[model samples]
Target: MRKPVLTIFYQFNPWHSTIGGVQTVVSNFIKYAPDEFEVRLVGTSNDPAQPNGKWQEAELAGRKLQFMPLFTLQNDNFRSLVPTTLKYTAALIGHCFASDFMHFHRLEPSLATLHWSGDKTLFIHNDIQKQMQSQENANAILWRRFPQAYFQLESLLVKQFNQILSCNSESVKLYQQKYPTIADRVAFIKNTVDSQTFCPLSLEEQQEKRVALTQKLELPANTQFILFAGRLHPQKDPLLLVRAISALTDLNVHLLIAGDGELATDVRLEVERLGLSKRITMLGSVIQAELTKLHQATNVFVLSSAYEGLPLVVLEALACGTPVVTTNCGEISKLLPANCGVICEERTPVAVADALRQVLLHAENYPIEACVRATEPYSASTVVGAVYSDMWHRWKQQNLVSTVQKCSTNFT
Candidate 1:
């Protein structure tokens, strides 16, 4: 028997980029998927070195995966509209028609899959409608002002999918509320982390890492570290974290921010303005190994995002045996075990500061063992790949039955 082909559509090249959460999710899925399934990815790339419209084979999770670039749209703006979208849609339709089943990583690319008559699933990684309302970009502003138009478009695209994989229960609720008719189609599948790579270190190992990191980063000995790792965009509310740190003047804590984005300059200015330059260190975008080390050495991980689709960083932190202080976003509140961390009711600076203060005060109560255990379900080996495999089988079976029904009707 031949293995089923699962083709995924997303804009960014996952093999090349590790910048966004979507990229991370795609990488993980492709890396951890079962060997019985043949995974293929279709996307656009800006890299001038990579030839467009060619299928390239790459190794991920010790498995061979294929990548086909639909077009070479170097500019981000053009990649979504006009001739670019048309060309992409044409290429994607052809690929979808050839594949056994299709998977989409974002709303925009999923739109192209609608043209193909095949079993398809859309993975909701973010609340698009919510994001538009909060973002200040010109396109987001337009969508916010004309939400009805946006909703109509969204509803049309969503209704086309045979199945919708929501990253969290919150997303499933949001989608069901928006499209009640498709309520049965929406299912919650939480994001995952590499537990082995992010597992907690022993006491001696932790001490050695802390001492080494302190010496290398030139930080004060015995100072507590609070880490925030993600893009410094408005949605992430990186400044709110900085303000929260400023409010904790009494505590001997240092805020370590990893990753850079549009608001990088503003974040730096905020740190300078609040006189937190000495208290906060901005380590612009570290690699995965370094990030794991940072999580291991940190006293607590902090995420002050206004919204999310279940951040992988939170899971990564927990897997590293570090507690968290985060806002109530996505399914984070549900995933966090009791005594594992603090969840802020509000996204304001004051609320975040209070939560951080509380967590810092009783940090020992959130044991490393508890944090590690809480993340058992989200490990790549345990849940993510298995859930994906089951979904694929279910959707494929449904598609086969529908095809047989259509044949019978034609014969009659």
Candidate 2:
């Protein structure tokens, strides 16, 4: 009796470098897999130090973590996608055939290797329609029309998936409306947070962690920190968060930015340009453990993304009992409440700054209990258990293989 093989594919290397939302989701599946399943990871070696187009593997959580290295333009422009898709296909040739179920974080890999796998699940972290249009303000007509062109191709690729999951209900609705053919396949599943790992501490613990974090930043004691965690990408707009923080001229306030990507240099320059060198600290590529600490210690968490599909950072922050001030991107307005977090309808720095100021000035309003309670429905135990169990049940019903069909869906 062989356990069913499942390969969770993300687009970044969790083995070497820090990962973003999509990678983190894939990692979560790997982390909480049921004992009856043999979980595997397929990610790209996105670091510069790694060799390009090379197949690499390492052990993660007692499973094989494979890397498909591909180096292209830092911005992930259209020029790079063709070769990137081809490379992903080549890398997944063996894994696709060996695995019973293939779960993908990015569509390009699955689209290219569709013929290689029988059971395919395409998890939607970013809505392709929104992502393609996110940067449409670029100063070219071709760029404006690019989203529609990409969406047309993506529409064709999407119908090939066995399942399409998203955390954002709006994204689910959009998919159902745009492509009714695959409407039954698309469903909204809530994102999960490890409440035990990201829980709030007592007042004394918070104070102690805050003091230590402040010292680590080389800042004076008792500094009020605003934390932003996301990739330095145009969609994330770390620059917007920097600008918002710069406008908060309060001497007690400081901003800590975590994560790294293409716009890292641009964000640094924007911070310097705003004369916020002292007020802002760039904590590049902080791992999940440290990120949980940041969420616990910070006064408020913020996100200024142009678009998203219910960011994991926000859920992690809430689970840590940190109130958030976020622009109404993705499902932020729906995911956050007035007590748990502040949602800004306006996307400008001034508006975001005001939201930050309001949260900072009135921290008592967003109680730690309320913030933590908001995230109760998103507990990892419930959500992850449901995901793995649901998939297992489906696999059994479909009889992907005779051996796996006999396995019970109950957590083994």
Candidate 3:
């Protein structure tokens, strides 16, 4: 028999949304969910044009999707916290009633709601409180609303869930470290990728595309190509990448940074200041297909982010058989095996540039098989299966029947 359906509720900010790891995981689950499970998406709207409304179901990527436009408080400042959170809480209340199983990505509605009913599964990507606690005072208010309310609320919500899914072992450990009593509740399932669609391009194809890209971007033939794809934000630290490139004077390398954000202008300014305009090509916001081409064309893929929760780009780059240069963040050690990439000790321009030069100079010495194999367990189907397995195991332990009607629901 097919397992019962599970409804995932999230307030998706679509317009500013990039195809990052979390979104990719959700999409991948929808694509290859178990036969016994019916996946329903309930996303909150970010449309300023239409704010006051309830959640509605629709089709996203040919899957059943539900989007709700709730009254949201736009600014992260103090005044809007309570009202905006209440709005989100109301939407979640509606979602809770509709869903057989509720999986929450964000803390807003979950924190606000009094009742924690049904087979609940909480997905905590990062320690939001821990992250916020470290931030400046201005940002701290956005982190904790109803500080007194949350005092008991977090404990209540944590106990209410049948299981809690974390992105990596590191995250799981963090949760265990904080809440040792609920150690059994926390589980780890790393993010996945679409292997068939995201696999490496042929050498000839890569070279051909590289030639076209070189001509289109006016890139020099002698210059070694290095790719940095992601948002140009403080979180991403793209300017640091420019500074890194600037420091790499000995190497004839050209950096192709793809993506734009709040730090876009700042990154450009840094490029100018360092006189790295010739060495760096800021190809702002290229689509996925083009991104694949860029990954294939590049000698090494680099991620210089200050922090991350298992970035999908790193996986994508590996799937494309491209070597990587990244800062030691999150579970990157688990992701990058052997010679697939180099992990820097710190997030500095000098550190990044030194790693970049080394990787580019002897890129071929890295294990190609290791690079490709690193992404094997993280394919869309494999990842989706793992998620179902974890959920099913939890359901079985709790002696609950899967409501969906597919017979191939066994975790094995």
lDDT of 3 by residue, 1-412 (tens): 3456677665544333453456556667676766566666655454567654555655545656555545543322123334444556666554344455677776566654447456777776653444434332233244344456654566666766767787656668866776888889888877777886577777788778777877877877666789988766555677778888888989878889888755677788888888888888888777777787788778899998666667788998998889999988767887887689889998788999888888888877665566788899878787778778876776675444333323346532
Candidate 1 stretches greater than 4 Å from native: 71-98, 135-142, 395-412
Candidate 1 vs. true structure, TM-score: 0.88
Error of 2 at 129 (Å): 2.9
Q: Could you tell me every candidate's TM-score relative to the true structure? A: 0.88, 0.85, 0.82
Best by lDDT: 1
Candidate 2 runs further than 4 Å off: 46-86, 90-98, 135-145, 400-412
Report the C-alpha displacement of residue 279, candidate 2, in angstroms: 0.9
* lDDT per residue as tens, model 1, 312-395: 899999999999999988778778976889999988788998988888889789999999998988887766677666866775
**CA error at residue 216 for candidate 1, angstroms:** 1.8
- Model 3 has an lDDT value of 0.70
